[model samples]
Target: MIETANYTAYFDKARLAGRKLNLAPAVINAILEDVALAAIANTDRILAENQKDLDRMNPSDPKYDRLKLTAERIQAIANDIMDVARLDSPLGKVLMEDTRPNGLNLKKVRVPLGVVGVIYEARPNVTFDVFALCFKTGNVAILKGGSDADYSNRAIISVIHEVLLKHNIDVNAATLLPAEREATEALLNAREYVDVLIPRGSQGLINFVRNNSKVPVIETGAGIVHIFFDEFADLDKGIGIIFNSKTRRVSVCNALDCLLIHKSRLGDLEKITSRLLDKDVELFVDEESFKVIENHYPVHLLHKAEPEHFGTEFLAMKMAIKTVTNLEEALDHIAQYSSKHSEAIISENANNIERFLNEVDAAAVYANASTAFTDGAQFGLGAEIGISTQKLHARGPMGLEELTSYKWIVNGNGQTRDH
Candidate 1:
């Protein structure tokens, strides 16, 4: 159980630690490398603790896959840490500079968003990702991981603290709060210490944080993602992209939830979705698609889609299909139901492709590709803290750069402001 009264002390320590995180770039990289090596060295221990969390969850639960960690996933997390170590730091760079007539030299420079607080669900990998990106960008991290992965998160944080202590760095640089409801409430109210709060989980969790947090929230919106199969879509390409997007990993936010099919392309729906049969993907079909695919798709997996199914994020082997008369209808449906995370169109027509890409208001819009690639590492940013669906501060996959904010630096020699 958490000593809820000590929440303020935790925030205070993290805030102070942020000041000391602006270390030299080389030193930061070295620390990250050590953490990566330590992760590999401690893989056995991490997996053991992760199993403790997994045992509590039923295998059928959507979060079960995310909560379980294996040696391969641990190695992948370690490799991503190494990738972060290799990348150039985004801190201290001059974004913009100007010289005024009054002899005032002004420059906008990149800096960290000090004391980034993340409230996340069962994905313990986020603990490492948030710490690596925040540390690389000279920011402190305060993690409020869900109780589902408490054991795993504690294990991961222990490894990080061991490395930080060895390097004489403050372990408070990456503080993991107690995994309890009281801790979450305290974090939501930590406006004085936490600069920004990021929530990564279901829509309910995101909404709770956004609605309740006194600290500014950067929402990692739940992915109610869609991929439109236009009239000009290539059968082969569409087949591959659609299959990979839905079945690659269903528990992820980027996994395809609703598939929009052009009425003209309804005939090709079976060919496009035939591969999903391998994974026993359950399809919730509309009136039109139901008629076309009812005989083709397995009876056990095929069901008539209700109104609620279109906007739902099915983090499982389930998917919904909607048939649209034209591109305009598809766009309208997406605008109505999309969470604006990742949207894609599989089409060969240049005009239709350009229109879809230009009009869709998603953080990551794709033409002739899978939505599954809506990830920071796939976009060549190593690991990501989360995918920001909001437009104000950051959008899409958040890397080291996204974790930073800019400040204006002004210099003048005896120049006084005249009002």
Candidate 2:
């Protein structure tokens, strides 16, 4: 319901605050500790606000789980904030140094990326994550959360602002823009103020941001994730891994969306997906997989696959199953349909695993494990802005180090270049 007439004011403030943020590591940690404590202390209030947002959405919607926050989820978010506070600050670390023959010393040191503007949907936890990760790196945060979670996002931002005000830090250092579409448009065009824009949401949202934004965009791509059940795959491992990958948290980006089984392993398909039955997972299966799973899986939840089913990121308890003749066919299928988010191969054969890991073009490649492990906290980076699928700046879970860029520092005493 809140709208800003001049969103540029927010961007300007963030840019200025970013340029001025040079606190000592201890100060930053102290502030972050206060924020974490504040979040936990305000648990009830955050929940109450979160409930308002949840009430507006259908519970059956895939984003409902992502939008709704509980006491335990809030506690986990606070823990991640503390984890970020405890990690070593990457700023000022000399990445490279050289002494030139011209009596000049040169060094490249890590620095913040300045103003990081994140446009995301539904997930209110991203507010805390963007703040924690950006603040840790001395980068300013300007978040534009979706309208669906506006109330929850606003509540979380207020807690952060309370802590910032207590520390006499500029509240604008972490700004949450209005949850209106206009705010998103303003943010997309603010290239002068925002160093980078990271979009975390559906493929449609990511694509929209990438195609339209004037600001340099870091694509946190949608996961049209897949896992291949190789002929040599251990059936025991394949069963458990696929189950967890699809059912552990279906709303997450890393949750499995497609399963590729070797033609020889088609017999084992029913057994592999046996656990998904418990979750009532809907399967869009190819002819081979459908024939194998026809009467095995719940008839109500099974359907023959269409061309559209192959590349879809079903952020629900729905998945697609394809039958590949060999490793090459599996690889080709994934290469065609994958969003390059996460890809996996379940196999005991060392050669097959190596080939899959090396040849699979994705942000993360797994061997005999669930793609669900593709996360920042699981990777030990505390929290992440998003999993970048692009090749330029960052790829995979963007952690503290990924939030930084290097600047060259040169020390010279009247040493000038002469031709």
Candidate 3:
């Protein structure tokens, strides 16, 4: 359980700050700009602290990649924050307005979600992203980062609180807890204070939050994303898409996990395998896909895919490959194994592209493109809190708008419920 002594005070202060922030989006923007500069000024300090965490883990661990924050990444983080500062306000905007039959003028207006609790594993960059996004949209954030990134998170959160204090904003607008399971559980169950909880990390973490949290949760990670190269796909173009999606940065949620190729394109599979080999990508190939390029590919990293491999999200330089006989088989395989984060199809045929786009159920479905574009920044939504896999109040790349809910506002002269 949380020690209300400190936790309650923080939430109360954050709630009040959230309400007050509704009238001060400009101040919020300035805070973001200042915070961005803070990161740049503290890059050496941030990376030094991050190195402490990294030294405790093996480079082979995927979490290591997620936890590492370098100078370039800090710069990128700062740039994205500035991008968020440039975005228009998301709160208090009228979604819709009209007059009802009883001559009552009604409108739906967006409102801040109050306090947002974010429980995430590794990735200290998320600390900056979540703060900038939540602050921009007027939602206070309580960040509980993973134990591995404890030092890194502390350094980052300290900077955030420092910036907030400088701007005379309540430090409670952003809070960081010691990374412990007990503390996470308390945060998960903080329904009385937190309006919403978002978990971004491994499947285990996401599942635990969903099963345990009394507060409403928005899931952000665990991507068993896939891409299909249909028979009609432009093979040269398809190869580039696959290479970029799978090899660009495998530690991300939007990175490709599986590759589905039409049986007719068996030769193209060899080319794709050979190209992946150059990037040192390990291939977990299905029986059919293995047979197609077993001896010809000449890559030691290649292995036959197991049942578990097909269902796995390889957040590394590893991926599963399946050869589908037809489009339906490819679609069925994706539907069966997808975490619904991002799925893509590379096809020149209009019908195949249209059907793939329409029939696939995912946060992002792409045509002749990589799944890498499934990001809040890439979608022109500034910095994203996370990509929601579940469909509820928010889905896909969660931007400032996702941190808001709407209420029905009624203008009535004389309204009666019984009327």
**What would the per-residue lDDT of candidate 3 be over residues 224-314, giving only the tens digit for each residue?**
9899989998988988999999988889999988999999988788888787887888888988888878887656787988889987988
TM-score of each: 0.98, 0.98, 0.96
Task: Residues 324-385, candidate 2: write the lDDT tens digits.
Answer: 98999999999999999999999999999999999999999999888998999999999999
lDDT by residue for model 1 (1-419), tens: 33435698898999899888879889999999999999999999999999899989999999998888989998999999999999988888899999999999999999999999999999999999999999999899999999999999999999999999999999999999989799999998887889999999999999999998889999999999999999999999999999999999999999999999999988998887688898999999999999998889889999998889989999999999999999999999999999999999999999999999999999999999999999989999999999999999899999988998999999999998779
Off by over 4 Å in 2: 1-5
Model 3 clashing-pair count: 0
Please list the C-alpha lDDT of all candidates, in the order they appear.
Answer: 0.93, 0.93, 0.88
In model 1, residue pairs whose N, Cα or C atoms come closer than 3 Å (at least 3 residues apart or on different chains), thus clashing, are: none
User: Which of the predicted structures, 2 or 3, would earn the higher TM-score when compared with the native?
Assistant: 2
Candidate 2 local Cα displacement, residue 240, angstroms: 0.6
